[model samples]
Structures are given as C-alpha cells and as structure tokens.
Target: MTFEHYLALFIAMFLVAVIPGPAVFAITSASIARGLKQGVNMTVGLLLADYLFILLAISGLAVVAEVLGSAFVIIKYLCAAYLIWMGISLLRAKPGTSITEPKMQSTQSAVLSGFLLTLSNPKAIVFYVALFPTFVAIENMTYPDILGIMACATLAFGSVNLAYVYLGSQARKLLTTPRRLTLLNRCAGSVLAASGVTVAVR
Candidate 1:
C-alpha cells in the first residue's frame, strides 16, 4: 500500500477507536474501579478481539472479493451507508451516562468481559470486512500487507484506549458535563459521516 493509503487507514481506525462506546466505557471503568493493570488487560483483550475480526475479514471477505470482483463496489456503498447510519445515530444519542458500577470484579473477568463485549459487536467485524477491500486491493493483498493493516489498527486502537485507561478519572470528568459530551458526540459523528462519504466516493 502507498503511504497515503496507510495514513488514511490509520486515521479511519483512529476515528473508530476514539468514538465513545461500550468498550470505551468498560475499559475506563475497569481502570477506575479495579486498577490500571485490569484496564490494561481489558485493552489487550479488546486488541486481540480486533485481530480476530481482521483475520476473519481477510480470510472470508478476501475470497468473496476475489470471486465477485466488481461486486465490491456495491459492498462499498453498503458499508458507507452503515457508517452514515451509525454516525447519525451517534449524533442523536443523548449524553452518555457514567459507568457507576464496574461489572468486572477481577482482572480475568475484565479481560474476558472486554473480549466478549467486543466479539458481541458484529459491527466491528462488518467494518473490517468493508474496510479492507476499499483500502487494499484484495487480489494483491499479502500476509505482510495484512500485518501492516493490523499494526496500524493496533496502534490506533491501543493508543486511544490506553489513553482512556491512563486518564481514568480525568476522562470521566471530560464526559461528565453535558456540553462537553455533546461536543464530543458531534465531532465524532461528523468525522464518521465524512469518512463514510469519502469511502463511498473514493
């Protein structure tokens, strides 16, 4: 992939990671209620889940892309539609509620919970399925290329997530105010929708 392509992928993944979601709340809450170690474990688990989704997307969707070929054009529009829908929904969402009770009692549970929480969200898998073909030429995609994508994903996802973990209580403060929360949602939604449109028309 060209450097531009890699940079675009990184930005997309970063947007996906920074948006507040259940996983984000879980990781932050784990850190606040338990410890940084627990939060780190959960982050690791989430990263592993991401890798799993990436692998599945590559192995399964690559063939479909290869056989169907031009059909991926349709898939691109579909993925773009999904992203737009998600963005709109996020935009309309009410201010996020605080995670008062940390459901994770132990580090093992924290990690497991993070994994299951991520796995349960089929959205990320579909995102990867849609994302790979749009950015990388599936026919020429190699193992190293896949690894490179995963590395970008890891850096993007891990950095934002770990930042939340590190911020801990401070992160919660940023979200506590309705004004700040609304602004966050707006910025995230706009970026998400714009990204979708970019993918669709690229």
Candidate 2:
C-alpha cells in the first residue's frame, strides 16, 4: 500500500474507534464502573474480535474481488452509501444520557463481554469489508498489504480504546455528559460523512 492509502485507512479506523459505537460503549462503561484495569482487559477481547473480523473480511473479499473482475467496484458505492447513512443517523440521534453500568465481575467475564459484543456486531464486519476497498484494491492485495491493514487496525483501535479508558478512569463524567457526548457524536458524524464522500468521489 502507498502512504496515502495507509494514512486513509488509519484515519478511517481511528474515526470508527472514536465514534463511540457498541465496542466503545462496552469498554468505556467498564472503565467507568470497574476501573482502568477492567477496561484494558476488555480491550483485549475487542482486539481479538477485530483481528478475526479483519482477517475474514480481507480474505473473503479478496476472493470476491478476484471473481467479480470489474464488477467488484459496485461494492465500493454500496459501502459509501452505508457510511453516509450511518453518519446521518448519528447526526440525527439524541445525545447520550449516561453510560450504562457494566456488570462483569471477573476478568474472564470482562474480556468475554467485550469480545462477544464486538463479534456479534454485524456492522463491524460490514464496515471493515466495505471500507477496505476504499483504500485498497483487494484484487491486488498481497500478504504484506494484509499485514499492514491489520497493523493499522490494531494501532488505531487499540490506541482509542486506551485513551477512552484513561479518560473515563480520570473523569468518567467528562465524556459521558449529554452536552459533550452530543458534540462528539456530531463531530464523528461529520467525519463519517466526509469519508463517505471521499470514497464515492474516488
């Protein structure tokens, strides 16, 4: 992958992490409820989920790209539409009221909760699969490209999770407040929308 593609992938992945989706909610709530240690443990679960899903998406789509020839390009537009729709939904949604109290009691449960939450979220698969082609030509994907993609995902997602944990540990109220959450949601929405437009235009 070129530097531009790598950078785009990094930004897209980072925004996804920052946007406070299911995974973020799960981790942040744990951080708020239990402590930073629990949150970090939960992050391990999410890391596992992301690794599994990224591998699945890249490998499965590589086959589709190989078989569909130029027809695979259609998937790009569909993904663009999906992203824009999500952006609009976030923008329209009401501000978050509070972080739900997480009830995981053990280390195993904490990790399992996060892993299951992320793994069960179909959106994770769809977004990763769809977003790949936005910066990569799956037909031309190599082992190194796959490795780089996985690394970008790990760095971006892991960093965001850690930041959330640290911030939530210090002042859980700061990020979970209605007003602050609203601003964050809108900012995330704008990033998502712009990303979609970029993908579509390309």
Candidate 3:
C-alpha cells in the first residue's frame, strides 16, 4: 500500500473503532465491575480476536464470509437481546453493592468472553474483508507494506478501544447513585440494541 492508502485505512479504522459495539460494552461492563486493569485486559482479548478476524478476511475466506453474512441478522438480534438483558441487570443492581464482590472472573474467562464477543459478530468480519480491499493495493504493494498497514490499523483500533475503557472506568465515580447507574445502563443498552437493529435492517 502507498502512504496515502495506509493513512486512509488508518482514518477509516479509527472511526469504526470509536463506535460502540459488543466489544466496547464488554470492556465498559468489565471496567465498572472489575476495575481498569481488568478492563484493559479485556481490551487486549478483544484486540487479539480482531487480529484473528483480520487474518481471516485477508486470506480470501470469502465463502466463509458469505455464509456468516447470511446469518448475520440472526446473530445481530441475539447480540441485541444479550446486551439488553445485561443492561437491565445492571440497572437493577443495588447501589454500592459491588458486582466484584464475588470471586473475580478467571483470566481465561475474561479473554475467552472478549474473544467470543468479538468473533461472533460476522458483520465485523465482512466489514474488514470489504474495507481492506479498498485501501490495500495487492498489485503494487509488497508483503511488508501490507503488514505495515495492518499494524497501523491494529494499533489505531487498540488505542481507540483502550480510550473507551478509560472512559468507562471513570464512569464508576458517576455511577455512585443508583438512579444514575440505572440510567447509564438503560442508555448503553438502548444504544447497543439500536445498533443491532440497524445492522439487521441494513
């Protein structure tokens, strides 16, 4: 890829990374319950999953992508329902009653949950497949150039996502009040559900 192509890819990926999704929700929920360190760890897991998906996208797995795309509507609805359930549960949580009171989730669970949450979204896979082709010049670019573009895109994605974790961690302070916490949960839930519906309809 040319420098201009890489820059464009970075900008596009950065914008997409900023949008809230299941991965963002997972990080925020983890931050609220477990603390910033755990939230960052969850972000790491998410990044790993994203890299895996990108690899699949680049490997010309168009058949798999098509199959996944065909089922994306159902997957999106399921994701929406799960987010709504989690949000309602959060809304109902008693104030000052710590979600981390019980034993913390194992590292494996955190990583696996993050990975599954990211990878299960077939739309994301298709998006990467479609997106990379626009900026990646297969004829003119060397392998190293392509790798560099991927690296930059990955770094941009991770950095933007970590910022979300930081934001969500700070939200713990504002969530001190039960009402405010409830409202936060509802709002996040609504956003997630709406995004899902939009995905399905699109």
Candidate 4:
C-alpha cells in the first residue's frame, strides 16, 4: 500500500480510538476504582481482542475481495454508509450516564472482563472488516502488509488507550459530566463523518 494510504488508515483508527467507547469506559472505570495496573490489564485484553478482529478482517476480506472482483465497490459504499451513520448517531446521542463496571478484584478478572466486554460487541468485528478495505487492497495483502496494518492499529489504538489509562481518576471525573462526554463524541464524530465522506467520494 502507498504511504498515503497507511497514513489515512492510521488517522482513521486514531479518530475511532479517541472516542470514549465501551472499551475506554471500562478501562477508565477500572482504573478510577482500582488502579493503573488494573487499567493496564484491561487494555491488554482489549488489544488482544482487537488483534483477533484485525486478523479475521484481513484474512477473510482477502478471499472475498478476490472473488467479488468488481462487485467489491458496492461493499465499500455500504461500509462507508455505515461509518457515516455511526458518526451521525454519535454526534446526536444524548450525554451518557457515568460508566459502571463490576469491581475487578484481580488481574485475571480485569482482563477477562475487558475481553468479554469487547467481544460482546461483535459489531467491532464489522468495524474492522468494513474499514480495512477503504484504506488497503485486501486482495493484494501480503505478510508484511498485514504486519504493517496490525502495527499501525496497535500504535493508534494503544496510544489513545494508554492516555486514558494514565488519565485514570481524572478521566472518570470529567466523564461523569454528560456535556463533556457529548463534546468528546462530537469531535470524534466530525472526524469519523469526514473520513467516510472521503472514502465515498474517492
């Protein structure tokens, strides 16, 4: 893939990562209630789940892309539509209530909770499968290319997540305010919607 493509992918991933979603809420809540260590374990679980989804997206899309050939364009538009819709939904969503997570008593429990919480939202797999093709040609995927995408995803998602982990109690305090969370979501939604428009028009 071109460097420009990779950059776009990274930016898109970053925009999504910056949004305080389910995973973020969980990690931040755990950290706020417990400690940074618990948050780190939760982050680890979420990252592992992300790795699985990325792998599935790359491998599965490669075959589908190769087979569908020209028809894949339709899928791209559909994915773009989904992205735009998600963006609009987030932008309009009412300020959410404070996050509440089960007390994570141990590292294992923390990790497991994060993993299950992420996996429970199977729509996340759809996010990976849908978005990857907008930035790279999966039909031409290689081992190195796959590795690069995974690395980009890790860096983009990890950085924002770690920032949240570090913020810890402070993040919890800020997020307790619905207006602050809504503002964050709006900023993220703007980026997300613009990205979808870019993909659709490109």
lDDT per model, in order? 0.66, 0.66, 0.64, 0.64
Task: Summarize candidate 4's per-residue lDDT along 43-102 as a digit string, tens digits.
Answer: 777777677667767678446545765554564465346446545655665665322333
- For residues 1-202, what per-residue lDDT tens digits would candidate 1 score against the true structure? 7789888889988988898865676566545433477678888878887887677676785565467656546655664564465456556766653222234336675566566546544446556777656876766778888889889988999999999888764553556576766665565556556645655675
| Candidate 3 residue pairs that clash | none
Tens-place lDDT per residue, model 2, 33-70, is 44688789888878887887777676684465357645
C-alpha TM-score for every candidate = 0.60, 0.60, 0.71, 0.60
Show the colliding residue pairs in model 2. Answer: none
lDDT of 2 at 72: 32
In candidate 1, what residue range of length 10 has the lowest lDDT sum? 96-105
Q: How many Å off is the CA of 57 in candidate 3? A: 1.7
Candidate 3 lDDT by residue in tens digits, 86-201: 44555455653544423335676556556655666544665676776777654465668757866876688889878887887787767777566666655554554554444344
How far does residue 130 in candidate 4 sit from its true spot (Å)? Answer: 2.0
